[model samples]
Every structure is written in structure tokens, then in C-alpha cells.
Target: MIRLPIKFLGLLLFFLLNVGSVSAQYKQTVLNKTQLLLNKENTIPLGRLDALKIAVVTPDAQKYGVFVQQLGRYADISSFGFSKYDEQTKYFNTIIVAGTEGDLSQEMLYMLRQSLINRKNIILCRFQEVGKNIPQWAPLLGGRITELAYPDFSDLAQQNMAMSIFGGLAITEGKAINRTEQIRLQYTRGEGSGLNIAKMTQKIDFIANEAVREKAAPGMVIMAVKNGQVIFEKAYGSHTYEQTVSTKITDIFDLASVSKIMGTTPVIMQLQEKGIIDLDSTMGHYLWQAKESNKANITLRSVLLHEAGFTPYIPFYRYLKPGDVQSKASTSHQTKMADNAYLVNHYYRDVMWPEMLKSAVKPIGNYVYSDISMYVMKEVAEHETATPMDEYVQQILYRPIGMKTAGYNPRTHFDKDRIIPTEHDTSFRKVLLEGYVHDQGAAMAGGVAGHAGLFSTANDLAIYGQLLLNRGEYGGMRYFKSETVDMFTSKQSKTSRRGLGFDRADPDPKKEYPSRLSNSTVFGHTGYTGTCIWIDPKHQLTFIFLSNRVHPQVSVKLYDLNVRSRVLDAIYETINEVK
Candidate 1:
């Protein structure tokens, strides 16, 4: 599937308060997919093919070299070969045949035609350093087949053009695939959005200004999408009171507990889809270590709902004796905790896990917001998938959704400045927590945990909100099934305001995590580090907020100011005013 940020806070001050690219003149008649058939097209015979096939009609794969490289950024290319005499090559969903009529024998041409007849998407690309109109196989391919001037654009732009041409229909070959577009969402800016932009803007400005003025936090990013179109987005304040740097819209922030939904829960949902983990099954069904402990009888559904009565948190760092500290990672202590701190190897396994299993409370069937729930669930997922949670979710969710900056341990993949500072770390690892995780437990676990340790920009989180809002599909790709999304995002427990793994709007409207304006249909999670991801299905909206409210020093100013929920209420009011 192929398709197609900054902020100024001084701009609005009204009712409610809170908060959180382009290339080219080239155009293609693009759809979500070719055969899922967005616009009218004749029937296509569906195949089990998933990956792209670069069918080089010329003897050398050299002709399609640059184009194939561009395609690689969009989708994984499984095989490349000459299409001559190979009827089996048609099994692939998308095929790019690079040859003019001159290079094709009658047999190769026949194979290409058979592929088209078999409903395979074939791209007739004329390899060129500069753009030219060589209508090579346009007639045969039945789509606009202009060879783009490679020099006029970037590799990313070239990939966008290819994606626009190939479309989203082919990726249906795989369950849970990426609809790789360089741009993830479409923005409308309140035009025809039913919301009152002027009033909304004024309130938004008030929220930002108040947050900064009240000293709750120096900076924040707020973004809202309504009816599938981004209606409002803004960034405000500086990275800290020092004001040495202004926070850009592209900056990624520490997403504390939001990691539960952003990573762990998604893995559990996907694993459930594969029949790897059963929600109703006991914890012992998956993790052998839990078998001999009190956790063995706990149900995964209870764990997700926070009704398993797990401990709210365990201060694993405090338990660390002086001997547990290491100047650096080693054979015995291989986990890096922070910029200059490392932890003993198998600390979580040998220490944390045993403590969790032996804890007095097992499954009390009562809601208790517990970090241990996510920790255990993360292990359960790793145990089932045989892959680390980070790697597994990256393969299945973030990468596929066209999310640019999402995953654990931002330091490994991004520049330090690109990741906003979470805190000055007055205690524990007494250093500025920039590019390192803010949660001590997750940092102790080496920056990959079920509950916290994720870091991402607002846009990446928005894509996830859109993923759930569209009922497990986005940009024409499906991740979880509609039912899976419903079960995970809808109310699942009578004892708590929780879906399977998501935090729902509080049943008692006054105490909603987001706002009293929110209904039960809203489902998402909040990060302790002043970040949130809220998606509403009934209203067709997704709201995201990211802030390092703990920067310099931990303070409750953001909550005391009601910055997030007020902005959310402003959105609802704006929409309601128009309606």
C-alpha cells in the first residue's frame, strides 16, 4: 500500500485548556490497494503472495538496481529474476518488470501478461537517471507508467511514487502488514471539520500558555484528529526552564506507562490472534516459572484488566545491594541502566521474577494499576513468540504502520537532542534523563519493559491511535482483526475502567483519565512522564499529548493545571459547537 510538524504556542487564550513534509509535484492515481480495489477495477484473482517481486526481464538485475533499492525502503523484496519462462513468478502480489518491448521475448511478454491476468500488480518501470516518457509497457501494464526523473527527487520520493502506483491492495497477502508511506496521516486543519477552529485555537493557546506560565512544565505537544483528519496540532514552550532549546514538533519524548499499549499489549493481542496465548488461560499455560509460584492460577485477561491484584510496583533499584552496581556491562552484569550505569545479568529473571512470583497477592480479581502486570505480560509474550518484545512489536506494528520514531531505547537509534529530556534525575541514576528511560524499573531491565521505556513523537503515537480508531486497520493495512481491536479497546472488566489491556474512560465520568467529557468509548493509556494516547471510536477521533513535565524537577503542575483534559474538552466543545 502506498500513499501519502512544528508549533507556535503564542498564537490563541477561552473555555477549556490542556494539551499536544512534502515532496513533489508528481501525482499518481493511488488507492489503498490495487485489488482490495479502492477505485473501480476489474476483478483480480487473489494469491497468498506477500512480499514484492522484482521481475527483471533483462539478463542483468542491474537495470532495476536503483528502483529496487527505493522499493526496499517501502517493502521487503523477496525475489528478483527474469520473468521469461517462469510461470511460477506470478505467485508474488507485486511485480516490477524493467524492460522495453525490445528486451522482451514473446515468451517473457506472455509471462508478464499472464501475471496481469492472474491479478498480479506489475510495474513497467523504465530505468533512467533522468525522467523520460518511454511508454514502454504502459499499454501492457494498464496504469500510468512514466519513468520518473530519479535526479529530480530523493529516494523517499521515488518510493512514494512507486507506492502510489502499486497501491495498498497487494499487501493484503500478509496478515498485519505495513502500508509504508513516508507521510502517515492526512491533515485538514479544521476546514469542514465541524469544529470551530478559532475558538479551538484560542483555548489551545490558553492551555499552552497556562502550562508554561504556571511553571507546570516548560514544553508540550498536543495533536487531535477528528473524523480521520488532523484538525489541530501545536507545540509550545522550551525544552526546559533554561530555555536553551525550543522543542520542535519532531522531537520524541519518554512514553512511561504508555509503553503498555504502545508495545506489550499489542504483542499480547497479536499473539492471541496467532493462537499463541489465550487470554482465558492461566499464567502457567505460558510461563513455566509462574507454575510453582502464586501467579500460576492467574488469568491473562485478569492481568490485562489489572484485576489480577498484582503489586502496584516493586522498588527493584532499592533492593540492589552495593555489589549489584557495575561501572559498565560485563559477562556477569550485561544490562546498561543509564549513561554510566549498568545492572547485573539476569537481574530481572533471577531477582525481579522470583520476587514477583512469590509476592503475597496472586489473582485477587480486583483492579490495581500495577507495573508488574505489564512486566509479566511482556515476558509471557517473549516466552510465546521466542523474540524480544521490542523486536516482535517492531516487526509487526510500528515498522509496518509507517511509524518513523517509535520503539524502546531512543538513544540507540536517534540523536540525543532528538529525544527530549525527561528529568534531571534527582535520585537513583543522578544524571539528566535524556535519551535514557525515565522509569527506574524499565531502565533496570535494560530499557525494554512491558510497562514503560518506550519513547516516540506525537505523530508515531497518532498512527497507533488511528490504527485502533479504524478498528485495527490503517492506510489500507490490517494489523489486528476488528474483533481483536474491539475486545482489547472496549470495556472488558466490570471491576475496573479497563479494556483488555487499554485504560478506558472511567465509568464514573468525573474521574476519567482524560476528561469528564470523555465517554466509555475512549480507550488508551497515559504515561507518568506527562504523555498520553487517547482514541475514540464513536466520535471518530484520536488525541495525543506528550510532555516532559518532570524535567529539571518532578512536579504536578501539568495535572494541577488540567492542561491535557481541558484541551481535550475544548476539542469536544469545538466539535459540539459545529454539530
Candidate 2:
């Protein structure tokens, strides 16, 4: 017998291993139109108009042919990098992929996320068929592989998994539907064919309860709202360690930077609605420059989006007490003043801040978040309303919306003992920031600047969220038209994931998932004092987490806790589909 060469046998073994790996990988492919399964067994009965329009990616052409025949008029095959447009160049509602694995790369997932950001829906079918070891940056898919052990289910399992993992929103038969447990089971029902909703519910319950048990945040109230209703509302920790000041669902907070959302932006919207202020109107149109520069051309939106180019931050307190000599604590980044100093040692009241705004050298291309923009906007808002910014907001926006606790300059409507303190001033203005505004620049502007210094409670803030969802109208009071509201909340710049003053989550959740509801329509803002508010119009969801992390001292590290995101993810998963 002729013996085969040892090297040839070794080569054959290597090829077999590679083939097996590829075959496993091949389970996830770009399905063609012919392979989509749309028969009565897999797809719900639908009229011609109701049939889903789907884009499938798979490597098996023959299987695709069979799938297309099985699922009549439901699926279309597309190349790997297909444009997200209909035959008429309009947007397509859904893209059906064979699974999360196979030909899809991190870049492709990124592109898919971009399409979703532009409001396109995505359907990842047979997702578990995709092997494990997926990249982290692929939002839904990455979370799926890491969180779920790639379970395969009958049609019911797939549908239920779609709902839970996607924040109770799922792609079914090519349509994006909100939370409803009464999902019509289109697949064969038997043991192992459907997701154990009971198990998923238990896991969700643990996380929500953990959010309350951990009690990591003090003086905080975190909640998630869907369709203007509270889905998950809980208070973790307390308002004060002493327990004298406690946090309540309706307890007021010093919204700090969040006031930008409640105080100034609403007034801007009203002005826009009244044709009083145009987004493109230049800052030079409002405030007279103390000095000269190209910043006069910056628009109102640029300031809100932090593109007006002032500076990240400055020690406005230094100008408050200039004559007093002081050394700040090393931990303070030398950002504060001596405890003994007063307003005499500073020049910020009228000079340093105004000079920086006037001397903003760059011409508005670089990203720099500045309080000066809000101050300037406040000046313009006052000029436009022929009233103070606070009064204008109260009369036209806050009062009408029933936001009793929201304000910039709180002349009288607050209790100091019940309020949270922000910082101990040691650089220039040597005083503990308490009931008054904590932002130095806003303090210099007399505690009523547009960018910061608004006090509020969660309930009042929820009303603000509801207003945006209502398209700027609430309780018959019209704050802005739906178009104007959309313009304010929609993405404004490439770099700034921000609309007028709203901050959106990174399109790819893995880079940083801001909230559980990943829908691109969601928008909100964060306060320097550990506060966040997010609104998702798609599911009508809202999440508000308020904490005084800045208490005792200011540290920016609390943002990575994963407590807020994890708790929110659990609450979203808790949503049930109505039959």
C-alpha cells in the first residue's frame, strides 16, 4: 500500500480545522432575498401593504431563495455595504441581517448605528447564529453576546429577546414595535421555543432592587418614564448623611447646569416660536463686545452646542477678590480661593469673564463648553423679552408648565436649609455655595446666567421632559411648535452629540451608552452637580438621575458608576408588551 506523506496529512488536518471554524462562522451570513422565512409558521398573516420590507444578508443563495418563497414579499437581499434607502432614495425602515456575526465588522456595525441614528430601524434576525467573541462597540449586538449566552429560540423566543434586549422595542416582521407582552407568537410553541420571560423578569427585578440597595448616590432621585408614565422610580441614599434633609420623589434639587434645559432653552424656543430670536442670529447682534474678536459671528445654537469657542472652564472666583492673597488646596486643582477671601480680591464681576468672551481668539470651529455663552444668551433673552431672564422664563415657560422649582435667580421661592451645597470657595469668592447659585460665572452675572444656576426637583424636571415630548406644548400652553422642538432636540453638530442644549448618547452604545433606550430620538443634558435627564420619544421614555456628587468636593469620576445605566437597562427590560 502506498502510504500518504505525513506533511500532506498534516495539511489536510489544518484545512479541516479551518473549514470547521469557517462553517461555524458561516452560520452567520448575509442572507439573500430568496432565503427569508415568511410562511405562516414564521411570519404573521399580513396584507400586501402590511408585509415587512426587509434587507437580508446571507452567504447561502439557495437557502435565501427558499426563504424568500417561504416568506412572501417580506425580504430583500442586499450587498454587505448597502445604502439605507428605498428604491426611490428615501430611507428604509428596517435592515434584516442573518445574525450579529459573519461578514459584519465593527465598522459595519458602526455604519449600521449611524443609519439608526438617522432614524432607520434595524432587524438582526437569527442573531444567536452569529458566533461569540463579537466586538464591544457594536451596540445591540455586543450587549447581546456579552449579556445573553447566544440562546436560540422559536419565533416567540426571538421576538421576546428582541423586545427585552432592545429596551422593550423590537423589530418584528420588519416593523419596529414598542413594549407589548401580548406579542402574537408566530413560531411553533413548545419547551425551549420561547424565551423564559420569568427568568428575564427576575434578573430585571434584581437590578432595580440593587439600584435602591446599593444606595451609592446621596441626595438623588433616579427614575425612568415611558409614554409620560413612571416605569421605574426609586430613591437611592439620602439627601444628607444626618437624615435631617431627606430626598423625596418630589424633593427639589439645585439643577445646576441642568437649569440650562429648563431655564434658558425654553425661553429661546418661545422666542423662536414668536420669531423673536433666530438660531443663526449672531452674538454680536445682542451683546456689545467689551473688546474685539471674531466671536461676534457665533450663533446662538453654537453657544448651546459648545462650539462658540470660549474655554472649558475658568476660575471666575479669582477675579472676585483680587486684593486678597490666597493658596488653594492641591486637590482643588488650585481652582478655588482662600476661605477668608471675599469679592474684593476678584475682577470677574465685569472684567475677566467679559474679556475672555471678547478675546475668544478662535472663530467658533473648536469645541469649548463655556458659561459665557449662556450669560450672553441671557442678556439677549432679557433684551428680547423686555424682562429679566428669570422672570421671562417664569412667565412664559416655567409657570405655564407648572415647574414651580425651576429658576435661574431665585429671589424668594426656595428654602436654604433644604437645599444642597456645591463648593467651598477658597480662590476668590470665599463662601460656601448654598441656596444661591454655585457656578462662579453665573454668580458673577448675579446668579441668573443662562448656562447654569437653576434649582429644581425631579417632578418639575419631568414636566420639562414631557414638554419636549409634547412638542413644546403642555396643558394648552404652547411653548413652541413641534418643528421648533425637533430642531432643538435633533443633533446639531458632528462632534457635539448635542441639539440646542440637549446631549444625546453616543450612537454606538458601547463607546458610552448614556441610557437603556438606545433610540436616537432620545435627548437630554447633564449637570456638573451629578444630574442627568434623558428623553426618548420613540418609546416615550424619560430617565432622570439627580445626585450631589459634587458635595464636599467636586470630582468628575462618578459618571462611570454604571449604576445609572445598568438600573435603566433593567427598568427598560421590565416593560411588558400589551396584548
* Candidate 2 similarity to native, TM-score: 0.58
- Residue ranges of candidate 1 with Cα displaced over 4 Å: 1-184
How well is each residue in 1-579 modelled by candidate 2, as lDDT tens digits? Answer: 989899999978754532211100001111111112222122222211112344443334353343333232112323333343333213354454433344345565666566556554454444343333543233554332112212342333444443222222212322123211211111111123123335544654465345334443445777654444444454555565455666666565667778777788888877877898887888777766621556777787788788887766666545433333333434322223223323322344346656667554456756677766676677678777789888777777665444556675443566665566655555445566666666766665556677787877676677677667767655334667876777778777877667787677777866556764565676788887777787777655567877776655565445545655665565555543331
Clashes of 2: 32
Misplaced by over 4 Å in model 2 are: 1-216, 322-349, 409-411, 424-432, 576-579
| Ten-residue stretch with the least lDDT total in model 2 | 23-32
Error of 1 at 511 (Å): 2.5
- Tens-place lDDT per residue, model 1, 1-579, is 632211233322100110110011111122222111121131122111233344433334564455455444334454456634355465566565554334555566566677767776655443333223433344444553322222223343334334433332122311132222312344435555445788889998998888988888879888997655568888898888889888887889999999999889989999898888889998988888899988888989888989888889999888888868777767887788777777888888788878888887845887898999998899899988889999999888876666668899989999998889978876687778889899999998889999999999887788788777766776556788876887787777777768888887877865756876887677888899999888876677889989999988889988888888988988888877766
lDDT, residue 2, model 2: 88
Model 2 CA lDDT for position 172: 30
C-alpha TM-scores of all predictions: 0.73, 0.58
Question: Whole-model Cα lDDT per candidate?
Answer: 0.70, 0.54
